[model samples]
Target: MELEQDLMVSERKKKPFRWHVLVFLAPAVIVYTMIMILPLAETLRFSFFQRDTITQAISFVGLENYIKLFFDPYWVEPFLNSLWNNCYFFLIHMLVQNPIGILIAALLSMVHLPGKKLYRIAIFMPTLLSFVVVGFVWKLMLSPLWGVSKGLMKSVGVGSWYLPFLGKEETALTTLSLISVWQFIGIPMMLIYAALLSIPDEVIEAAECDGVTGISQFFKIKLVLILPTIGIISILTFVGNFNAFDLIYTTQGPLAGPNFSTDLLGTILYRTFYGQQLQPGDPNMGAAIATVMFFIILTGVAIYLFFIQRKLTRYEM
Candidate 1:
């Protein structure tokens, strides 16, 4: 009888606290499914169908949309252009933003820096602002009317270099990408800074005793320890850059104008779904585009995980 009672108690103990788990997880799971997973699945499904012209009825099209998207010159050209532009944007963030973030993080990690908290707060304030605000703020700063950029350049004896960057097809995309980098550099900075802070003082002290001080110590000791954090930051940047929309949309408008030179996958998806001046909206095509984007992002992430991340050996410090 005692054994039976103990077994019952043990079984009860082993049983999951169902209400507790539900309380902790239910809301997040529900919201994530409804907002992200469901919509994504529905969009993928919609990509495989076409709507009737007159009746507005959706019919199964299998690979027809994909076929057209790849082969049709009109669609293919813009699609490829946007894809390349998006790649450039991602590359710039990787090359420029991440390095700059590392440099800033390194500087902020220095113990002798005065008012470090103030500097951190100031630097990170931009990331806290909405994309719309950043876009508009940069637009004004770069505007000829305001002369902010020009004035700064003039002060440095390079006033003649100032041009209407956003109005030029050649520079528009790059300019917008830089603006985005400026706004979000804080994210990687903060992440890396935190990782740097988490490093043991004993390790740093030992390195210092070994005659590794200043930048050399940082490069050899601190940076090696922060590789895992850097990996995380890189992946986060990848996902965010690939899914980016609002900054480009706000700064360049939905059309990604200057003769569509700044067009990215996000803007293209928006234009296809909602239509613009000359083109009528095509939901099927839009869904197809979105589905393609999803695959592209997934493929990039997979490559990062399998190739780049696997090669990066993270040291426990």
Candidate 2:
């Protein structure tokens, strides 16, 4: 009995560490913690502090930066404008990108479609191109002076309809939003395509048995099944749009020009953090803006997790 008890105790105490799991996770955890987490935490911490412009001294000032961001006329006007522009950008992507993606995905999912791989490659190829390249190319293409877009429009009997889209305040943001949509639409297409393909053969066969076919079948069955994926795509679009800086910066410069018509939160943040031509860099204010962005993204993610995800019922495959 004593020997058995001792053996049992020894066995219980002999806990082996899962070294393999730690080994696999260590690299990713270390990298993420070092890069993402540390930077984010530092930004948040910095936001609560203030810097003296004249004396060049830093001091703790809880919420003053945020208060100024919300209230000060110097900051509030551009902030609101950028916020609205960001929303418009996101709305365009949601309306144009996702639907087109779904349509393309549905078409590609068709069994008898020829050269599906070729079509997929063509649609997705632009996504792999650098943003700088895309922006520069699009800028040249849209240039009213000598752009091929103008020639193409004239070829299609619409030469008079061509406008300098990127040069006008009214059209700049919308035009850039459309350009962004064109670049990233393939993401939603591929994701929705995968989701559509993942729908079991059994479910599809059952749907067909009930005289459901063609567009009716797609709307009734496939669309319903891919709601979760669409939701995911929507959230991703929101995050990406809010975080957007590269293409806008590459195309419109730090001012997000056409009279700041194309300004977004990201562009504003960059300008604030790094300083524009006349304005000096303010790290504290930049950190505060970044914190706001973080919360905005967090709120969106939280909504999706707590409300949207709960509502979206995942059908078991």
Q: Best-fitting candidate, measured by TM-score? A: 2
lDDT (Cα) of model 1:
0.90
Q: Please, what are the lDDT tens digits per residue for candidate 2 over residues 96-190?
A: 99999999999999956678999999999889999999999999999987769999999999999889999999999999999998999899999
Candidate 2 backbone collisions, by pair: none
lDDT of 1 at 111: 54
Per-residue lDDT of 38 in model 2:
99
lDDT digits (tens) for residues 91-174 of candidate 1: 999999999999998888875757898989998889989999999998898988998999999999999999989889999989
TM-score of 1: 0.91
After superposing candidate 2, which stretches have Cα over 4 Å from the reference?
1-9, 16-24
lDDT of each: 0.90, 0.95
